[model samples]
Target: MRNYFIFVIVVFVSLSSSAQHTIKNTINNVELITVKDSKFFKGDKPYYFIGANYWYGPLIGAKNGGDRARLLKELDLMKAQGIDNLRILVGAEGDGGDSRVHPALQYEQGKYNNELLDGLDFLMAEMRKRNMYAVLYLNNNWIWSGGMSQYLEWNGYGTVPNPFLPDYSWDDYLNYTKQFHSCIPCKEAFYKHVKFIMERTNAYTNIKYINDNAIMSWQVANEPRVLISPDHETAFADWLNKTVDLIESLDSVHLISTGAEGKASYLQDIAMYQRLHSNKNIDYLTMHMWPKNWGWYSINNEKTSTITSIQNANAYLDEHILVAQKMKKPIVMSEFGFPREKESLNPTSSITNRDNFYKAVIDRITQSKVEKGVLAGLNFWGFAGFAKTNSENGKWLHGDDFTADPPQEPQGLNSVFASDITTLKLIKDANLLLIE
Candidate 1:
C-alpha cells in the first residue's frame, strides 16, 4: 500500500509540472501580444519584464567582427540578475561623426552595412536562447545615433542644423528634428529600412525576423517629439499613425509602439499623449524621464539636487500612470536614471544617491503592480556592465566597446554595472516579487 501511494504522488506531480510547461509554451508562442484589462498578456499569462536599454547589443552580438565574448557575458549577467527584456537600437540612419559610433549601418540612401544587420541577428538568436525579449527601436531622434537630422541631410537639405553645434541651443535641435515629421523622402527612406529589418531572416537562429519570439515590440523612434511648433503637431500625428500602420501591415506577428517621452510632448498637452496612443494597432505605451534634462537635478550638486529629483520623478511617474490607466493600456517606464554621486563616471565611484533613486522607482512600480495599475514594465536608462570609458577624461572616444551609455552623454554617467551591489540587489528583488 505504501509503495502504491508513493507512485500515485509522483505521477500526480509530474502531470502537474507538464501542464504548467504547456501553458507557458502556449503563451510564449503567441503571434502578437494582446491587451487585457490594462495588463499585457501573452496568451493567458500576464506579461511583465524588468528590462534595460542595451542599445549596442546588436553591435556586440554580431558574428562578423563583433564582441561575442562580451555579449555572452553581459547577457548571462543580465539574466542572472532577473533581467528578461532589453531595448536595443535596430539600426541608425545617416553618416557617422567624430562624437558618434562610426561606420553606421544605413549611411546612404537604401544602402546598409550587412555587418550591423548580422549583429542584430546574433543578438536576437542569443536572446531567444536565454528566454529574453527585445524592444528594438527602428530609429533615433537624436544626432548622436545618426538619427532624423541625418535623414534630412540625405534629402539635400543643406545643413543638419546640428544639435552638437556650439551655436545651437537644445530647443533649436528639437525643432530641427521635428522637421523629420514632414520630410517625404526622409520618411520613405526610414520605411525602407524598417521593412529591410522586419523582412530579414536571422542568420544565427534560422528564424524570420517577424516569426522570432524574442522580439517583443518595434518602436518607431527613440523619444520622438513634436517640439513647440503648431504645424509639427499635425505632422507628428500623421507620421506616428502612418508608421504604426506600416509596421502592422509588414509584420502582424510582432507588437508596435511609439517611443514618446510622455507629458513632454511639444505642447506638454496631456490630451495629445492620450490621443497619439489611442490607435488600435499600437500594442503598448512607453515613456522616458530625464531628471537632469528637465532641470529637476543638477549633476554638480548631487546631495540636494538628488532629493528634489526623486520627488519630481515620483510625481512624473504618477502622472503618466494616470494617463495609462485612462487609456486602459499597459505602460512601461522605458527610461529613467540618475548620475553618480557628484556625477562621477569612474568605475569605483559611489552610487549612493543613484541606488536610493532606483529603490524609490522600484518600490513605486511594486506598489503599482500590487494594486493592478497600468504600469507593467520598467527598463532603466542603461546597463553598461563591465565596459568603461576609453579616454582619460571619462568620455566615450572612438573605438571604445559600445556601452549602454549613448555617445550624447558622458560614458558611465548612468550605466549600472556588476559592481553596483546595492542597486543590483534592489533590482533583482523587485523583479522577483513584482511579477506573477
Candidate 2:
C-alpha cells in the first residue's frame, strides 16, 4: 500500500509538469495578432480582411440544439470565401427571456451552463483548424443578450425593463443599464465572469485561452455605451478602465478592444470616444454604423436614401479614422448592416441597394490598405449560412434559424445568407483586393 501511494504521487507530479511544459510550448509557438503603427499584423505580415458577425456560432456549436454539421459547413463556406476573421459573442447571460439569447452560458451569477461552455470550446477548436481568428465580445450593452441590464437585475436592482416590451421605453432601459457601471456587486460579478472565460483551457485543443492564437482580441462588450446622460460618463470610464486592466493582467498575449460604437455610443461626441480609448491597455479602436438605425436611410425614399446613407457612412468612417490616425492604433468598423431594398426581409428580395452600400464600405477599406491608413478591417453585420427562415412575416419564432439579425429583429433584416451570391461576390472581390 505504501509503495502504491508513492507511485501515484510520482505520476501526478509528472503529469502536472508535462501540462505546464505543453502550455509554455504553445505560447512560444503561437503567432498572436499584434498592432504596430496603426495596423494589424499576423506574425510579420499586415492582416486585413472582410469578416462577418457570427454571434450564434457557439449556440450552433452546442451539443444539444447545436448543429455541429451546420457549423462545420458554414465555417467551410466562410473560409472558402476568404471571410476569415469573425466577430463572435463569447456567451450570453441570465435565463433566455424574450428577445434574449437562449441556452444562457451563465444562468446564474458565477454558475455557468457547462454545455454552452463546451460549445464555446468546440467553436474555438474548429476556428483554429481553419486558421481563422475571432474577436470575442464578452458582454452586451443591450437587453437582447441579457448583458449589463441582466447583471443589474441579478443583483436585486429590479426586473429588467426590456425596451421591446410595451411597458418600457428605450429611455427606461438605458437609465436602468447605466446603473451597472456604479453597482459594486454587479461589476464584481462581471469581473468574475471575465476571469472565468480567460482562464479556461480548451477541451479539444488542450490549449489555454491565453495562449491560443485563434483569438484576435477580447472585446469588452458588444456596443457598451455610456447610456442616456453625460453624468454616467465618469462611472462608465472607470468601469471600462478597470475591466480592460483586469483583462490585460490576466492575458498579456491577446489584444484588448472596447467594442464601442464610436460617437453613437459616446453621446454623439467623438472627443469623448477618443478620451475613453486613450487607455494604454486598449490595443485597438472599434466603431459600428447602422444606416437605418441612425436615420441615415429611409425605406420611403429608397434610392435617394441609399445614396444619403452611403455619404453619411463615409463621413462617419472618416471621422473615426481621423481619431484612429491620431491615436496611432488600428480601428475596425466591426459592425454595419443595411436592410434589403424597400426594407424587405425576404431572402429573394432585391439586394441592389444593400450591395451598393457594401461596395462603398469595402472600397473604403481597400483604399485605406493602399494608403496604409488606420482603418484596418471591417466585419459586416452577419452571415446566416444555410439557415432557412420564414420570410412571410419575418418574425423569428423561438426555435427559428439564427441569422445576421438578432432575435428581437426581423429574421433576415440584414442577414447575408449562403444564397446571396451577389453580396458574397462583393465580399469575395473585396477580400481579394485586401489580400493583394
Candidate 3:
C-alpha cells in the first residue's frame, strides 16, 4: 500500500514539473515583444536587428509587384547575409480602389492583383521556415488613388495623411473617416489576413521550420508625423492612435508597433497618442529620421551646412532616448538614410562621411539604455530599387533621385557604409539577427 502511494505521488510531482517548464518556442506573442523582462516575457532573449524600410507600391502587387520568386531569391540570399525582418508596406487606404482588400476578402469585381497577396503569402512562409519575423508596416505617407486623398496637396512635410494626398477638413472628412474607419472588418478580417499570410508561406516548410506561425508584428504606420507645420497634427495623431487601438482590439495575439514618422513633433505626438490610447497597446516605438537633412549627419561636420537642422536631431535623440529608455520600449529603426544629392546637408561634410555618419550615429544609438534593453533592432532606409523608369517619376519621386553626387550606384554611399550583408553576418556571429 505504501509503495502504491509513493508511485502516485511521484507521477503527480513529475506532471507538475513538466507543466511549469516553458518551451521558448511556445512563447506568448505579446510577451515575446515586451521591452523588459516581466513574469510573462523573456526579456533576456538576445536580439537580432535585421530589416529594410520600403514604401510606395513595392509590395501591393502593383506594376513593380514583389513576386514570390523574387522575394524568395532575395530573402534566401539575405538570410546568408543575416536578415531577420522584412518591413513590407501597407497604406491606410489601398492604392487602387479595388486592390487593397485581400483577394480572398474582396468581391470578385473588386479583385485586382492576387499576386500581391501571393507574394505576401510567400514571404511569411519563408520567414517562419527560417524562424524569422516579417514586420509588416501597416501604413506609410502615400495615396496612389481615391477616398481620403481629395483634399490635400503635396509638400515635403510629414503633415497630413500623405504629402501627395489632400488634407482633411475635420468638418468634411471626419464623417467619411468615421464611416471608413468603422468599416474595418475588425477581428474576422484581421485574423483572415494574418492567417492567409501564415498559411501561404507554410506551403514550403523545410525540416528546420516545418511548423511555425506568421511574421512578427503588425506595424501601425510608416512615418506618421506632424512636422514643423501645425496642419494635421491632431487629426493625424488621432488617426494613428485609433489604428493601434483597432489592431489591438481585433487581435491581441501578434505584437503591434507605432511606425512613428521621425521628427521632433511627430515623435512627441506618437508618444502622446500612444499614452492616451493605452501605453501597453504598443509593443515598441519605431521611427525614421535623416539628421543630415535636419543637420546631424556627421558629428564631425565635414559637410558645410546650417547646423540648426542637424542640431535638433542630435539633441532630440540624446534627450528623448533617455526617457524612451526608462519607458522600456524596444527600439526598431524602420528607416535611416542620407540623401546622396549634393544638396544633402551631410554631403561632403566634417560630419557627413558615409561610414563616419552611419557608424558613428548607429554606435551611439545602440549604446543607449533603450537600445540595450528593447530597442536593439533597426531596419535602414530601403532594400531594393531599380533605375527603371518610374511612373511616379516627375510626379511624386522627382527629388528621390538615387543618383549619387557624381552619381555612383544609387544609395552607394550609405549602402557601402552599412554593408548590410556583411553587417548581418557580423551581427549573427554575436547571436543577433540583422536583416535589411
Candidate 4:
C-alpha cells in the first residue's frame, strides 16, 4: 500500500513538471531580432534582405469583407519571391472619410473597431507562420490616414485641413499638422493608443505583442516630418523622444525606429536628422526617396531623367549612409518608388525604367553586404500582390481593392503587382545574394 501511494505521487509530480516545462518552452521559442555592432541578426545569422510596404495587410486580414484567400495567396507568392520582411501599419485612426482608409481600426478617440483589431492579430499570426518579420508603424504623418491630424481634430483643434481637398492648400495642411507636436491633449491621447496597442495580446496566437517574434520593430510613424520651419524642430524632437521612451518602456525585446525620411523630413537639413536620431533609444535609421516627388525625375523626360534619378538617389543614399556610420547604426532606405513607363497607372505598362531604378537600389545593399557596410536593408515603396486596380483612371473608391498606394495616391502609380515578373526576379536574386 505504501509503495503504491509513493508511485502515484511520483507520477503526479512528474506530470506537473512536464507541463511547466512545455509552457516555458512555448514562451521562449521565438528568437527576437537583435542588433549588435551596427547590424541586424536573427539567431546568430546576419539578417539583410529586400522587404516591402504592405501597409493594408491588417485590413485585408479582417473577417468582414477581408479576403483571406487573397491574403494567403499573396503571402505565399511574396515568400516564394524571397521577400520576407514586411513594413505594415498597425492600424489607422479616425472616421473613414474621403481619401481615407475605410473601416478604420480606431474610429474615435479611445474607441476601436474590434474587427480591424482582429485583422491585425490575424495578420501577425499569419506572418509568424511564414517565418516573416514586420516593421509596424504606429501612426502616419499624412492626413490620408487621419493620423496626427485626426488626433488634433479629436482634441477640438478644428477640422483637419486636408491637403487633398480643394478647400485647403499644402501650406494650410502643413501648418495645421505641425501643431500636433505642441498639442498637449493630442499627445496624451496618442500615448494612450501606444500603450493600448503594446499591451494587447494577439487574439489569434494568444501571444502577447511584446513576446511576438513576427514584429521586427515598432516604428514611430510613417514619414514623420518637421514640416515647413526649423522652429518646429524642438517640439518634434521632444515628441519623438517621449514616444520612443514609451515604446522602450513597454517592450524591451523589439527594436524601435522613427520612420523618418532622412533630411527630407528635417527641412532638408541632414544635421537635424542626425541630431534627432542621436536619441539612444532609437535602434536604427530609416530614409525614403521619391524621385518624382523631389523633382529628380520627370515622366516626360524619362530617358535622361531616369539616369539622373539614379545618380541623385545614390548621392542621397550616400549622404545618409555617412550619418548611419557616424551613429554606428544600420540604415534602411525604407521607402523608394518609380512610376511605370510614362508614369502610367496600368499594370501592363512597361516597367523597364522602374526595374532599372530598383536594380540600382538593390545593388547598393548587396554591395554593402559584401563590404559589411551599414546600408543593411531596403523595402521598396510597396508590394501590391494580386490587387486589381483601375488601370484607366487609378482613382480609389471606397470598395475598390487596396493597393500599395494610399487612397489619396493613384492606385497603381508606384505599386509592384505580382505580374511584374522581372521586378520579382530582381528582388529574388538580390535576396539570394544577401543571404549568401
Candidate 5:
C-alpha cells in the first residue's frame, strides 16, 4: 500500500510539469528576430526582405468592419511574390470621420475600439500563417492620421495651425508639430496608448503581442522630426531616448526604432542625424527619399526632371549609406517612390520613371549586399493592391473607398498594384538575390 501511494504521487507531479511545459511552448511559438554586427538575423541566417508599406492593412483586415477577403488575397499575393516584410500603422487617433484617416482606433484617450484591435490581431494572425513579418508604427507625425496635431487638439489646443493654409507659413506647421515633444500631458496620453497596445492579447492566436514573432519591431512614430527648431530638437532627443527605453522594457522580444525620416529629423544635418541614432536602445537606422516633396522633380518637365530626381536620389542613398556604415548599423530605406511619368496616378499610366527609380534603389541594395555594406533593405512607398478610389484625377475625399494612399496624398499616387508587373518583378528579382 505504501509503494502504491508513492507511485501515484510521482505520476501526478510529472503530469503537472509536462502540462506547464506545453503551455509555455504554446505561448511562445515564433522565433524572435535578433541583431548582431549591424545586421538583422533570424536564427543564424541574415534577415533581408522586400517589404511594402501596407499602412491600411489592419483597417482592411478588421473583422466585420473591414475588408477581410481583400486582406487575405493581398497577403497571398505578396507571399507569392516573395515579399516578406510589411510596415503597417497599428492605429490612428482622432474624432475625425472617414474624411480623415479612416478607422481611428483610439479616438478618445483611453477609449480604444476593440474592433480595430481585433482587426490588427487578424492581420498579424494572417501574416503569421503566411510567414511574413510586420513593422508597426505607433503614431504619426502628421495630421493625416490625426497624429501630434490631433493629440494637442484633444488637450484643449485649438486647430492644428498647419502651414498648408494660404496665409500660414511653413514655420507654423513645424512649430506646431514640434510642440508634442515637450507636452507632458500629451506624452502621458500617448504613453498610455502605447502601454495599452503592448499589453493587449491577440484575439485570434490567444498569444500575447510581446511573445508573437509576427512583429519585427515597434516604431515610435511615422516620420517623427524636430524640424530645425533648436529647443524642440533637444526635447525630441530626450523623448526618443526615453520612448525607446520604455518600449524595450515593455517588450524585450521585439526591436525598437525611432521611425524618423532620416536626415529630415535633423534638418538634413548628417552629424545630428548620426548623433540622434547613436542611442544604444535604437536597434537600427531608417531613411526616406521624396524627390517630389523635396523639389527635385517637376511634373511639367518629365524626362529632365526624372533624370535629376534619380541622380539626387542616388546621391542621397550614397550619403545615408556612408552614415550607416560609420555607425555600424543596418539601414532600411523605409520609404521611397516616384510618381508615374508626369506625376500621373492613373492605373494604366506609364511607370518608366518609377521603374528606373526602383531599379536604381534595388541595384544599390544588391551591390551593398554583395559588398557586405550597411544598406539592408527597401520598402517602397505603399501597396494599394486591388483597392481603388472613386475619382481617377482628384485628391482623396470622403465617401471614396480608402486605398493604400494615405489621407495626406492624392488618390492612387505611389500605389503598387497587382497589375504593376514590372515593378513587381523588380521587387521579386531583388528579393530572390537576398534570400539566396
Candidate 6:
C-alpha cells in the first residue's frame, strides 16, 4: 500500500498546484510587423468583431444583475443576428495597476474588489463556451471616493474634467500615484500590480474563446496622459515598450491592441503619445469619437450632418487605418458611439439620426479593402441591463430622451433606446449594444 500512498500524495499536490497558473505555450519567435492584406492571415475565415463596450464590474460595483449568465444569454441572442465580440475593462484600478499584488487575486481589498476579476474570469470563460471573444479594457475615466482617485477613467476625457480630487498637475499626479496605496500604471504601483496580473492572465486557462486568438486584442491604456512629458515620442514609446514587455514576458502568444479614441492623444497625431505607444507592439487599432465633443479642443464640428460629424470621425478612422496598415496592424472600431442630439460634448444624436450614423460608419468600414483588412472586428459603446446602475446616465449619454435640455441641460441631451438602435443591426444582433 506504500505505492498507493505515493500515488495519492502526487494526485493531491497536482490538483492544488493547478489553481495557480503558468504559461504553457509561447511564441518561439516574436516579430513587430505592420499588417498587410489582413485577409492574408485568415484565408476565407471572414474574421469579424461586432459587439459593445460595457461597464467593468470592479469599478461599477456590480453585485449580480446580468453578470456572466446574463451576458452569456445576451450573446446567445445576438448570435442569431451576427454580432460576436464584447469589450470589458480589466483595468489599472485598485491593486491591478500596482506593482505589489493584484487585488484581483487578493481577497482583502473590498468585497467588490476580487469581484472584478471573478467577473472577468466568468465572462471570458462564458465567451469561450459560446465561441465569443472580448476586448479587455486596461484603464478608465472615473474619479474616486470623495474624489480621492478614479477607478474607471476613460481616454483623455477624464483629465480634462480634472476628475480626481485636488486636480493634480501631471507631475504631481505621477508623484502622488507612485506613493498611492493602489496600483497606478506607470507609477511604482504599476510594476507590481499590473505585471503580476499580466503574468497570471498569460497562464493557461481553459478560456479558449480568448486564447484561441478568437478574441480581439488587449487595449494597453484608455484615453490616457495625452501629452506624455519629456518627449511624446520617447514617453509613449517607452510606455508601450515597458507595458507590453511585461505582458509578453509572461503571456507572449497573444495579439495586442489599443482601444484609443482616435484623438491626437489616443489614435491620431502620430507625433503624440498613442502613435508612440502603438508603433512598437500594438497588433490592432480601435477608436472612439464624438466630433461634437471636439469643441473642447477647438475643433468645432457643427452637428449638421450632411452627416459631417460621423464623416469626420470616419476621416479620422481612415487616417488610423492607414497608420495601422502602414504598421501592418489591423483596426477595430472598438468604441464608437454618437449621440442623437448633438451637445457641446458627449453629444448624443437622436435615436433616428444615430442609426443613420451607425449605418454609414459600418458601410464605410466594411466596403474598403485597405481598411477592411486591418479590421478584424468592431464593438460599439455599451451593453444594456446595467443602465439602472446609474439612473444618472442610465443607458445613454444624454439620459433616456433627446430633448436638448440644452440652453440648460447639464445632462446635455437624451435619446430613446429602442427607436435609435432599431436601424443599427448591431443592436439587434446584440441587444446589449443599446444600453445607456
TM-score of each: 0.90, 0.94, 0.60, 0.97, 0.94, 0.64
- Residues 1-436 of candidate 1: C-alpha lDDT, one tens digit per residue: 9999999999999999999898666445633456789887755777766789999887777667678898999999889888988999976666567476655778787888888888888888788888888999998888888888888888877576665678778787777777888999989988888898899988876678777777889899898877766567788889889999999999887878898888785467777788889998987888887887789888777778888988988888888888888878889989987878777887678889888788888888788778777888889979988775753366666667677788767888888876788888888888888665
- The whole-model C-alpha lDDT of candidate 3 against the native structure comes to 0.44
Question: What stretches of model 1 exceed 4 Å from their correct place?
Answer: 1-33
User: How would you encode candidate 5's per-residue C-alpha lDDT over 292-336 as one tens digit per residue?
Assistant: 888987888878888898899888888888888888888898888
lDDT of 4 at 145: 82
Q: How many angstroms is residue 187 displaced in model 5 relative to the true structure, after the best TM-score fit?
A: 0.6
Better of 1 and 5 by TM-score: 5
Clashes by residue pair, model 4: none
* lDDT per residue as tens, model 4, 64-140: 97888889999999999888899998768887797798878899999998988998999989988888999999999
Residue-level lDDT tens digits of model 3 in 1-436: 9999999999999987776564333432222333444111224455546455533222432223334444455556555555556676532333333222222212231232555544444555555565556667643332332222311211111223432234544334333322222233332343343333333333233211112334457776455455343455555555656667776776576677766643443545545533433457777666566665455544454454324434554565555444456666655666666544342322232223333334544554345433345445556655443322222221213223221111112233333122333434433443332211
Query: Could you tell me which 10 consecutive residues in candidate 6 have the lowest summed lDDT?
Result: 25-34
Worst 10 residues of 1 by lDDT: 25-34
Residue 183 of model 5 has an lDDT of 80
Alpha carbon lDDT of each predicted model: 0.81, 0.91, 0.44, 0.92, 0.82, 0.46
Instruction: Report the C-alpha displacement of residue 257, candidate 5, in angstroms.
Output: 0.8
List the RMSD of every prediction in angstroms.
Answer: 6.8, 4.5, 9.1, 1.4, 2.1, 9.3
Reference-based TM-score, model 6: 0.64
Error of 2 at 274 (Å): 0.4
Clashes of each: 1, 0, 32, 0, 0, 45
Ranking by lDDT: 4, 2, 5, 1, 6, 3
Greater-lDDT candidate between 3 and 5 = 5
Best by lDDT: 4
Task: State the local distance difference test value for candidate 2.
Answer: 0.91
Error of 3 at 9 (Å): 27
